[model samples]
Target chain A: MTQPIIRLEDISKIYGSGNTEVRALLDVNLVVEPGEYCAIMGPSGSGKSTAMNVIGCLDRPTSGRYYLDGVDVAGLSDTELAHVRNRKIGFVFQQFHLLPQLTAMENVMLPMVYAGISYNERRQRAEEALTRVGLANRLSNKPTQLSGGQQQRVAIARAIVNRPVMLLADEPTGALDSQTTQEVMAIFAELNTSGITVVMVTHEPDVARLTRRIVWFRDGQVVHSHLAPSELSQTAVFS
Target chain B: MDMLESVKMAVKTLTANKMRSTLTMLGIIIGNASVITMVGVGQGAQRYASEQFESLGPNVLFIIPGSDDARSNSFDLPRNLTLEDAEAIANQVPSVEAVAAQLQTQQNVTYRNRTANTLVLGTTPEFTTVRSFDVERGRFFTDSDVQRNTRVAALGSELAEKLFGTANPIGEQIRIRNVSFQVIAVMQEKGAFLGNNQDDTVIIPLTTMSNRVTGNTSPYGTEVTVISATARDEASVNAAQFQISNLLRLRHKVTTQDDFVVRTQKDALTIVGNVTGALTLMLAAIAGISLFVGGIGIMNIMLVSVRERTQEIGLRKAIGASRQDILVQFIIEATILAAIGGVVGTAIGIGGVTLIGATTPLKAGVSTTAVILAVGVSGTIGLFFGVFPARQAAKLDPIVALRSA
Candidate 1:
């Protein structure tokens, strides 16, 4: 149907050279369509993080073709790639990497700072994003003052502040307790329901079940791909 | 990103660790303060020396016997300058305004019961004009008194008061070297010069001093001590020196090395000025080393900051910051530190100058050039020292940095 939001073909990533070389990824192919919620699940050292990094444009694949929103990003220069990340991909790490010195509102406004938005508009959009994440009254509170779930919410607000094409999250709820994880998952689910595309990597099967589709990786290669039961279709399943 | 925003970010980061930032800036502060203060003091010393030289006279020259080398070597100076030579210079040289022949001897003076050891000066009536002496009461010795060898003397202000207290001593007789002489005039006040008291001496006719008091020791002519001569004006000092030297050479019948030397007030001023100026430059240079150390301190602290903020760098890069952005951010932080230190240090240096002026003879003088140069140098030092650490931060790979963190 429509062009995929992200398309990867024959992707392979090598860590080192000669005897010490480790193949982090091997001939992996994947496609994510618009308004879709996809989860990548694998054990530790299964190349899930490498696949996430590649999808987020934080790292270039050793040999592959990556088309993000219709442009070949694998051949882009460093500056151009940075611009693409700023304009196209939003990142949310498991650590909730918030600058300690900045307040919640300032942290959320950081991405737009590189987007060259006007000061008034940047502040307005940041306030909207914080409010959307249920942090309206906590705008002036620094990251250390916020709880783990609230900090993740702030990180999510920062990720989407630029209105990037897709949100690339790596274990967004990995650091939270069961209740906080549900709270964060609710926010992501709500954001996804509002037509945002989300690509997440998590080993938890329950977390993967919340997404519309799941891709399973083993030994640096994707071994299975299928739609969740609700959206299951025989032609969409891969074995 | 906007420069204003970058500066805001830098300021925020710096304020987060207030004590460390202040300690980092302390080196620059002390370095700038010392440079400014030393230069100010040096300039003040130069001014003081020039004023002292100007106080000697408008355009005066001292014709001392023997060369500078001979005086420093402690060689005995020939008593070659005679009264005839002084008279000849006065009449023969047009550039020579007035000349005073002086013969000085330390002797004890007694006025009734009061006795004080003082210098008895043998001089002519032209002494008042050549030495800038004013006759406050009565008048100086006339030429006729010199011709007749009259036993009359003029009292300096301090000596007049010492011998007579508030009482007038113009007509009183005082015994010098156990010989009685009448005081003809009382001079006005003149303070000390080069640690020697000018108002503590007695002036009398050279003829009386040579013939009656200290008998002529030189067999060649009426021998006198140093001759004090004045040029017609500022422009005539060199001409007067040249003419006087030639006249003395002929009068003494000198061949290879002349037996006399003429020195000008300007010459002495030049020598003193050079010495103080060089000293000031040396002080500034020494203080500059501290500024260099301050620059190194900035580099050291910046390096540590970059290392500590490796994770932050990765976060910023992931948020779409380019290498240039990180570089500019860190560089701006360093520049702000140095600039703030420079300003505060200048203020402290000005305060120090004021304190020095209040506590000492030097006036409160601030060299604007020194202040500007110090600030400029510190800013440049910050930039120069900041490049390495900033580049290190900018060049860090986002994946490696985030993973390390």
Candidate 2:
């Protein structure tokens, strides 16, 4: 009877109304247990991205109850949602959005800054996180000075530096080449194996196959869920 | 988020674009510098004027035969004040220590071959005490010389040099309107007062001037141009003025409006002070307008910055930054720009004031209140103007911002 890390009960997101009504997400229900490596698979306009935004605390569901680690966060204010995201969730974008002005270590220290952590401890933890991502030597390098693979590694380090309940990534390898994509995939796998829950959103079947489970979205609802990798081989569009 | 984090982030962001930051702060810099320097110069001008007036003499008063309205309306002052009036004041007014009656007129004089027009000052021996003029060379004329109407004159410093050319002319003769007079003494350098050259004057006995150059002291008495009086002490100046006014009114038998005016040194100082103070206020106000425009400049730049850094804002928002955090960061950045600009401008302003003080007659002083107010005002302008852009940055939609760049 353990609490789920993320629980969405009847979530809906609508844009406009009447003649121009567009339902981005319609009555979607989702549950993610702790330590689960999950992938959300869909085509364009499938509402998977909308679900990711709602789950990441970057957007509010139009209607529904969202429980994050046993807390009813659906009724929370924007500031309260920001606090939850800082303490309980991490995000990695496809473009590896590391601030150009900051070094790898400073980028990793950003989340802790919002958490009200002191400078010394933030430095130590950021160093440990960069080292964990095999970028200990690149701690002082800016994003412009790093390669795509290395930049992805820094973004990953920034993501997990705060020790969140789950890591949410949107097309984490969308901008990487095949080799760097594999490298980034290996890092995600290692993080998930070390007991950090990972939720990824991607349309590539090959990328989706790498995860432990796949939840498929069609239109604005969850159409199916796969519990095993063997079931994901039947998908199309291999990279 | 904590304040230090916001400030640190702002520093990093601003330092990344040093050129843009400096250019953005230029308006504030100019505004603050002009404000400080202009106020200092204005204050210095006031001090210079007062100093000039003080050099006239301690607790001195001038009795002129013109009312305030008449003096302001025209330059043709009535020649109603007399030598007898001055003598009466010296004898009657208890607070008056000494008096000097003058009948000043321009005359062409020849000393050997050197001929020049000179300011012939018909004054008594008490002129030396009332006007604080000293005899730099030879001896001044005595009371016996004035009583006997001796044809003698004392040249001012420059007048003596012009006529004698460094040679001793104590026993030589000079001509005033064809009347010859012996040289007595050369007066000290009194410098220029009210644009009139004191060193270009020739002092002669009042009796001699009337008898030889002017005319006889007949029906209307000896008509003097102006009467200068001094008080016994600094504190008795008002008493001396009041007593002189009453005696003149009684002697003239004035039943209605008094025809003469008694002006003190303090009265002149007050008028000069008010003029300079108003000028300072006007200059400072103009500088204040520039400061306000500087704030507008800051707002413009900050708005552009917010628009340019949309993606960065999106990324920060995605990584757990609240709207308040974003707002605080941008506002702090703007304030830092203004505060730094204020400090640098203040330094430049102080330098400007110092230069003016050293090179000019104006002793420009940098007021502490002005410095503090300038810095504080610039910082506040930054904060005030920063709000709109900061709020625009904070209100950005993360999804849209992320997709734009």
Candidate 3:
């Protein structure tokens, strides 16, 4: 019932040209409504990462219409696209790309810096974001000093620092242990419940099952879309 | 990010790699120090030479015979100066305070058993006054000695000491070219001038030196070699020289080329100034080459820094740093390095110069202008050499950079 925050229509992405051309994506259509939580599942070379990059405004689709909040993304300049990414989308990577030189609090304040917030206000907001991720005491620690799970939490804090409209995570728990992965997933689910749309890419069925809905991608096209089971017993039975 | 935060980050990055940062700054430090010290040395030399030249009175002038062509080429010796010429100048020229004519010859002087090769200077009674010579004992030749052609000579202080030892030579006789002459006075110590030892000569009456010592009867009249004159003050020296030149021209009936050269103390001072100025310029230019090489070193190190910090650059960009912000950060890092190096180098340069001054006769002067120039130039070199690496760091793609690590 809610208007879709992101829309892609008949998207096709081709690499190279002439005889050497290869279709990376063929007539793929997808929509994500505001406040929705979804996971994209696919095998190797299924074009899921490419789709994620395009969706996150890190890359442009070859020949397609990508609308973010009703604005055509293909028509925007590189700088404008970056602005869109800064204002509307937050990205969480598997490797936890936090600046090693900056403290945890300073790293979280990065997006707010780009947003042109005053220094005091940026500090206050960044502290609040870190506190929300249970890192209030670790605010002064650098990325190198934190554990893998703690660093991922810091990254999540940084991603949500500006309170972006959507969070695009690509295998966010790929580098974490099972226990830490569960903790990061719990934080993601909590953020999603607070009305921030979350789109995650994962090859693990277990990780994908944690989301509310799942979209299975095969050979550059979505083959299946369904609601995940509310209980782990039913999800295990379905798998 | 705010400027303060950017600067803080820059400083933090530099301090993180202490050895690399120090090594990078070494080039700039040596460059700045070399520039300051070399220029300071050159300036000091100039000042020392100028002060020495100033010590020689400015009102002195020398008139010597022979045209420039005859002097340069060993053609024929021109005889234009005479004792009469000196008398004429002293009487006619109002600017001329005194005129002394000199005729020189080399002879063997014997005092008892000791014999030595020495210079014999034949000059008028006024020579001592005009040349600023002081008599340590007895007195100089008088007008009566010149008129009577007295075989009397004044022993220079060193020559007297060498020949007579502790004996008083005032009223003693010394043999010059086998002819015995009475030593009327002992001239005081006068140091070296133009490589010639003024204190190693003996002064005698002009007629006695020309007739007895030199044994010359020339076709030219008197055959005086040089006419030394002095003006009342510095302001009158040029006027005295002009009058002497006109007088010589009239006496020699010269129509085109001059047969004599009039040299003044001011001319000697100008020549010394020009030579020292050229030397200072040359030294500065050679030192400037080292400074330029130091700039190249800065550029090389900055390039290496950019390569080493590639991952850091990516992280910063991913964290929302703009291209300009990255550029400014790197530039600030370079500037801090050079500024610190510049201050240290300036202090080292001043210390080096002071040390040299203390150890040698060379007077080294500290120039505030050189200090400012050294610091300013180092800062500029930082800005200049930092641009390329900063641009490279700024132009990196955030996505590709983030993926690099």
Compute each candidate's TM-score over C-alphas.
0.82, 0.87, 0.76
Candidate 1 segments exceeding 4 Å error: A228-239, B55-58, B64-94, B100-128, B133-227, B248-261, B354-359
True interface contacts retained by model 1: 0.55
Worst 10 residues of 2 chain A by lDDT: A230-239
Q: Interface RMSDs of all predictions?
A: 0.9, 1.0, 2.7
Whole-model lDDT values for every prediction: 0.87, 0.89, 0.83
Better of 2 and 3 by lDDT: 2
Residue B42 of candidate 3: its Cα lDDT? Answer: 76
- lDDT by residue (B68-139, candidate 3, tens digit) is 898889766776677788888889989989889999878899999998888889999889888788899998
- In candidate 3, list every pair of residues with a backbone clash: none
Q: lDDT-based ranking, best first?
A: 2, 1, 3
> In candidate 2, which residue pairs get closer than 3 Å at backbone N, Cα or C atoms, i.e. clash?
none
Model 1, A79: alpha-carbon shift in Å?
2.2
When summed lDDT is taken over every stretch of 10 residues in candidate 1 chain A, the lowest stretch is: A230-239
Q: Which candidate ranks first by lDDT, i.e. highest?
A: 2
Chain B TM-score list for all models: 0.75, 0.83, 0.76
For model 3 chain B, give the 10-residue run with minimal summed lDDT: B313-322
Q: Is the docking of candidate 2 incorrect, acceptable, medium or high quality?
A: medium
